[model samples]
Target: MVIAFVISETFSIYSFNGIRIQAETWAEALMKKGHKVIKVNPWDKHNWEEYDIIHIVGPCEFLLQFTSSLVSKNKNIVFSPIIDTIQPKWKYKLVSYWGCSKLRLSCYNHDVRLAMKNIKQIYVRSQYEADYVHICYSVPLSKIEIVPLSYRISPCLHYPQKENFCLHVSILTSERKNVLRLIKAAIKYKFKLILAGSIDSEEKFRPIDQLIKKHNNISYLGKVSEEQLIELYSRAKVFALPSINEGVGMVALEAAVYGCNIVITEIGGPKEYYNNKAYIVNPFDIDDIGKKIELALADDNQQPSLMEYIQNEYSLDTCTKKLITSYNKIVSC
Candidate 1:
């Protein structure tokens, strides 16, 4: 089967964002399964008829427009909406009333309706996302496939002896990531914190840099390599991801696999994975997040269980097989 893995030109496979990484992983995994996979950029010219299925990863504005065009051509398109957040109706209404770029909103609304009407299959990471796609986008329940993100399970070659600090990893510039709140919580709790990820710009990350300078306990390590990250995960006592929104919070899964105690928000994807095992916190409350971090640090009993569960349930092999099955079903239909 020939699959065109379509994504936005702005989406970098090497970037730390979950969607980009997932797109890369999907392409590689499909190829490994002996399927012909082609990476398609939205702006690039391609023979649309050459592929059996055009699998688009994220529902960004550009990709949405591209999908709409493909729908007009009646191509077999499989969409992974990756809807990170479902805004309330009132929020959309308010934005529309304020005339805050109605063109963008109009495009989004139109494209969502087009996808619901035309796309062959829609894939989502968690039940939360599946519900959001069904309710918010008005997509049929039958068209939605719940396929969780996959992570390669690697044995930790060098597990550090001292597991002392709390770790958070994400792109710092995203407002939805809520990095400032995490910083405040870390400072208030007096917990040693290490943050990893790339900043969009030095100017944009100034506040974070200032906070890092002011606090002795909080440090920004910029971006670490994959090996270094695994080592950090193995050495960290707690992994905190209090993001305002997330598709799956992939870093938390990676940390959990390394036996780090988790304290995550109950917003989107993390809730589906962590459930009752890790300490769940309200992202809006600093005190609650701090308390959860404290609890994670003090109690070390749950790490092994969490790690074992994630390993059993979310391995790359399992998710890849699920995805291939979905692809086959879509094409066969």
Candidate 2:
């Protein structure tokens, strides 16, 4: 069997990032099953008909044009849309409406519709997304299957000695990520807060800049290499990203594996996976979120042995095997 992966982004540099890791692990797993897998951007001008299977990693319509432009009815094309849903209760209606709009567009688009007409299988990450796809697009439940994205435990050389701060590693731009709200809470609680990853834009950064200057408790460590990020995981006592919405909180899982207590919003897939290991709060309630943080910081039993939990549930080998089983079933059908 020959399997090919088509993604729109540059694969070499950013491939190790969260979603790409699933793609890589799936390809590697398929190889062990005697399938030769090749990963390419669907937007790249490559011969598409040569492989036994062509998998699209996301729903980017641009890639749809590039791939279908070259080949007519590539029999093995598969759609994998990893939906990231993170929204507060009040915002669900608006988000669901937006999703419905996207679904309508997908049904009408020439490339996407053509693929839908020809493709035999669609893969989704969770039951939540699978149900949404069915409700929003009216795609048959039989045509879609649930395959959870498995995360590999990051290699740990040294664990940092944790102090009194909580950590957040998300794109810092969204007002819903609630960084400003977290900052105000930090001032009241006097607990240090460390932020990692890129801020959404410079305009959003301006207010954050003022807050950072005014308070010693909040430190912004801009975009970091993966190693440095893991180092941040090592030192933090608790990890929190009270995003208004999230597809799957990959960072939360990473922090959990490192034994950091979690404080997260009840949104999206993270709500499904938290499993009593976190402090789930209402994303809209800033004061309650702050009090939860304070309570978590003071709790003695907050940090459990998360390394074992992560290894059992989200190891690379386990996820790869599950994905391969789905692929075999899809392709053989």
Candidate 3:
């Protein structure tokens, strides 16, 4: 089978993007299984009908044009929107309006849902995203598939001596990541916090930079190397991501398996993955998030046995097989 993955054009490469990572992982896994996988930009002029499936990684306003182009040429396409609806519809609409007017987003809520209707299948990370797509876009439940992101564990990992600091990894300086609130929480609780991720812009980084300077416990590493990240995960006492939302919290899973106690957000599909091994907190509550981080730091038996469960369910081999089966089923029809 030949599959073409459509990459986003508008989003910058200056910051780390998990959705892009997921697409590349899936492409590598598929290629290893003897399928030809090709990377295609959304706006590129290429032979669309040559591939068995044209898989769009994430939804954007640019997708509306790409979806129409694919339907006119090939008609076999699937989309992984990664859409989650923790907010009420009213709030979502209000925020979408604000995004268009203030942030200059081309289109947010409506255009995204409209782009999925003509696609052959919709791939989502969880049942929550599947249901949201079905109900909001009026897409049939049969058209939505739950194919989660694969968590990769390093083959050459060595557990270092543990430290007392908590580690949080994400694209730093995003409001959606809620890192500012996390910083305040760390300062108030007097816990050592280390952050490792790309800072998107100097405008967004200014406030976070100031807070980091004022607080002795908070240190921003500003995007460490892969080796450095693994070492930090190995030595940290806890891993926390008190974000506004997450699809399945893959980094927390990696940290949990590496002997760091998990403290993650409560507003998404994390509960489905972490089960009882993680501490879930309201991302809006700084005090509560701080307390949960402290609680996670104090946990003695930090739930270091999640690796087997992840390998059995969310590993590259496990998810790639499911993805190929879905691809076959979609193309066959």
lDDT of each: 0.79, 0.70, 0.79
- What is the C-alpha lDDT profile of model 1 across 5-80, one tens digit per residue? 8766666655455677788888898899899988875467888877888888886666555666777664688888
Clashes of each: 0, 6, 0
Q: In candidate 2, where is summed lDDT lowest over 10 consecutive residues?
A: 92-101
Query: Which portions of model 1 show Cα errors greater than 4 Å?
Result: 12-17, 41-50, 60-75, 89-105, 152-162
Which lDDT tens digits does candidate 2 get at residues 191-283?
889988887589978988898889888889889888898778887888887877676677877887776788888766675665666788888
The candidate that wins on TM-score is: 1
Q: Show model 2 residue runs off by greater than 4 Å.
A: 9-25, 28-34, 41-50, 62-74, 85-117, 152-161
Better of 1 and 2 by TM-score: 1
Better of 1 and 3 by TM-score: 1
TM-score rank order? 1, 3, 2
lDDT (10s digit) by residue, model 3, range 1-333: 999988676545635567787888899999999999989863567887899999988755577766866698888888888775587655554543333434545565656655666688889888767767766666788888888777777522433467888999988877778999999999999999999988769999999999999988999888788778778888898999888977787877777656677888888777667656778899999999999999988877654555445546777888899999999998898
Q: Would you estimate the TM-scores of all the predictions? A: 0.86, 0.79, 0.84
Residue 109 alpha-carbon offset, candidate 1, angstroms: 2.5
lDDT of 3: 0.79
